[model samples]
Target: MSASTTLWTDRPLLGFDTETTGTNVAADRIVTVALVHSVGPGRENETVATWLIDPEMDIPEPAQRVHGISTEHARAHGMKAAEALDEVAEMIADALRQDIPLVAFNISFDLAILENELTRLGLPTLTQRLGHDIAPVLDGLVLDRGVDRYRKGKRTLTDVLAHYGLEQDGRLHTADVDVSATLDVLRALTAKFPTLGTSSLEDLHREQMGWHRRWAEGMNEWLTKKGKTPDVNTVWPL
Candidate 1:
């Protein structure tokens, strides 16, 4: 690759995250979402778009506690689910069409949830808009696990931000906050591991697929040994 060609680290990155009614991708509704666009190494180079949606369903107390968005708040202040879903999905597709890598903590969950929302609303899923599979995603969590296999601690967004000596940008679990924080963590990850910053997005995307599967298979083995259900999704970007 030519040095003049922008790497994923330096080129435009679209950071994504969602606050949902629950963890059930197929069944839950997307209550909020953030798509952060970064064209440089700093937050000053970023433009963020966020949305709160009335999911047209109850937001359970547990989910409410995590994202602080109650069904009542959504009903009163949020946009209609279908309208917000259409706008959000198109923006994401537009970004991807321009070859911007979507950066997120655990991208599969957010990407899957967004796709499901679009499908549930009878709108075009991102894949349908892009005319191909989603590609060139940069998942900070998957890459972090691959590079530091022996680190013993939680890999939550909070844990990762601290682990990388990156100060907390803001409160997490909120859609916009988590999205920007994930981008910061990825910047730190690439700085610490130079190869990650230098590799082409296509190569990095392919490597992450293998990385996520290996992590999942190993986690499944450990869970099996403990006689517990293996709950990790082994797929990349769903």
Candidate 2:
């Protein structure tokens, strides 16, 4: 990225992602989580912290196929879910305390599940730890929606990375790898969209909130027309 861009990404960006047991924010558990800290592009000055957690439940076959983390593997080598989640929650809250944005693909899903998991384990949620709603979140999915409202295809992590010229690398579903890819996509997105790169972090975060709402409404409309249930939540981040 150019040195001239006054992007939030120009500062220390902490990219976060999680591979879970399932898609339900309330019912699912996180099997693996990754937090990637990058001080610059090209992966220079980066630190990655990852954890494999024993979700304490059977991983459904579909989830196993998506992330390749079977119950057997996790049970054999993973940290207890509550223990790992406690540390993860602390790290995230600590980062946000310093005004660092929590970067994720579709932050709501992960953050929501994380919140739920924290509560499930009798631990403080991120918001409780921070004493406020998490701020300065940089969601790649929301940013992509904001920048390209009419794009026709999927906006998965790999999809957006490819759209923005970042390679797929066949590691999209892995936690740490997905975190790295997501940060790269953000850098690319900023370089291509000047308005996004130039906005203050708070402004960008607020914009994403609105953009996500519109996208959700549009998606629900499309789903309704197709005789399908409209289940997209408009919440910015949990």
Per-model TM-score on C-alpha atoms = 0.95, 0.94
TM-score for candidate 2, residues paired by index: 0.94
Candidate closest to the true structure, highest TM-score: 1
lDDT of 2 by residue, 43-117 (tens): 667799999999999999999999999999999999998899999999999999998889999999999999999
| RMSD list, candidates in order | 1.5, 2.1
**Cα-based lDDT for every prediction:** 0.89, 0.89
Model 1 residue 128 lDDT score: 94
